[model samples]
Target: MRLHPDIPPGPLHEKWDNCRFSNTLVNPANRRKYEIIVVGTGLAGASAAASLAELGYNVKSFCIQDSPRRAHSIAAQGGINAAKNYQNDSDSVFRLFYDTIKGGDFRSREANVYRLAQISNAIIDHCAAQGVPFAREYGGTLANRSFGGAQVSRTFYARGQTGQQLLLGAYSSLMRQVAAGKVTIYSRREMMDVVVVDGQARGIIVRNLLTGELERYSANAVVLATGGYGNAFYLSTNAMASNVTAAWRAHKRGAGFANPCFVQIHPTCIPVHGDYQSKLTLMSESLRNDGRVWVPKKTNDL
Candidate 1:
């Protein structure tokens, strides 16, 4: 059977609004019956698990790190993009969408990109409400900065640790759900396989890194936020433990990989320092705002 995305039949601007209104809502009383297993605890996974638990679902969140906050997302140094137009730079949802599409060379789906742009402002507001401590101007308003591929000063940041602050916000929410007994967190557990029952993902098998023990977890649905397969290259900006194992196992269980070749390379990564170096360090993309890019004409030139 072929799959069709439930894209609403309307103008590009109205599709998301129309779809949200037309979608079916689950009764709050019945939400407790569903158990969702969210693999990985980065920004996407933690936020998802927290949000689902807040909506009354029983959520099991897993991460390979000793603490959920240590997920690779915390290593990101750049700020997040939002269409707040705080600088009155003519930035809008459409402009953000167009810029993203152009940056991706128009390979991204219009619906997905448009939806991301639409929610960009809400993301910033949500983060700020979580006390993310974003950089602000002397007037006490949130500060904005220009980032690569955008002319507007629309990137909201928290000094140079934007990802850390953002992850802390989500991590705080996740821990709140844990305290309320709405979410269960499995740290230092790496997903080994996706268990498919009757052609549907029903559970997962994970390995306890500390004890080398294998465990089975059954859930109504499994969400893989296990990040990318950049580690497949053997040398990348990904964490040391970042691997394709989870995604690879899912693919073996009949999940199709999309755009596997669309891996991104940060041009600002630190040059390899030695032959033994295992991972590349990334300089924040925001540095381009003032830093210049150049190369030495001779090997001995500093």
Candidate 2:
């Protein structure tokens, strides 16, 4: 089989707009005919499932945690990046894309990176509409903070608990879908395998963590938004339960893993002191807004 990203053909700025206008649209009445199984309820999974259900598709969202809000995304304390340019520092979609590409050593795909920069503002708007309680300025406008590797202040945060607040916003949206009977959520269920039928992913086999029973679920499509595999390092900052089980199962079932070597290191993680330490705690990157990072001149310097 051949792999092709099938990126839309157009100039960088126009590609996304062209694709959106050209893509096929499912009729609203026919949306209910399809069932989508979304594995993992992190920001991506929860938002995708909720949005699809709101568009009239039958969605079954699963999370190993007791609640979608407990997903490892809640550990993200730094803040989210956007190109809103509220600081009037000339930040734009292209600048955000360029900064990210350079920050990643230009290894990321241009199309994907540009798309991320484009939709970032929409994400903030959506979250705000859901009452995310983002930090605001004295004038009652949204606040912005400067993070590393960026000249402009484009990071939007909710005090020091940005991720927790964002997750709550997404959880509220998911719950709204559930209350409307458009989405069914299953917590404490871990995806153990992807069920591919006739070379197409058709369903999944999940293990109920609470019951220790394996259950098979069939769906028209399967969406794997499981979080990263940082815990594969055995002592990273990820939650202990945030293993790569779902991703590994999918890989074993035929899905290809990309850039497995690209692991992000948080420079502010707490130093490991003993063998008993199971995970590293992160010092929020937002601290850099006021604090400076430096090393001691002597080995014993405090």
Query: What's the TM-score of every candidate structure?
Result: 0.95, 0.96
Best by TM-score: 2
Candidate 2: residue pairs that collide: none
Q: Write down the lDDT of every candidate, Cα atoms only.
A: 0.90, 0.90
lDDT of 1 at 27: 98
lDDT of 1 by residue, 116-175 (tens): 999999999999988899999999999999988588889998877999999999999999
Error of 2 at 25 (Å): 1.2
> Where is model 1 more than 4 Å wrong at Cα?
1-6, 295-302
Q: What is the per-residue lDDT of model 2 for residues 11-60, given as tens digits with 9 covering 90 to 100?
A: 98888899999999999999999999999888999999999999999999
TM-score of 2: 0.96
- Alpha carbon lDDT of residue 244, candidate 1? 78
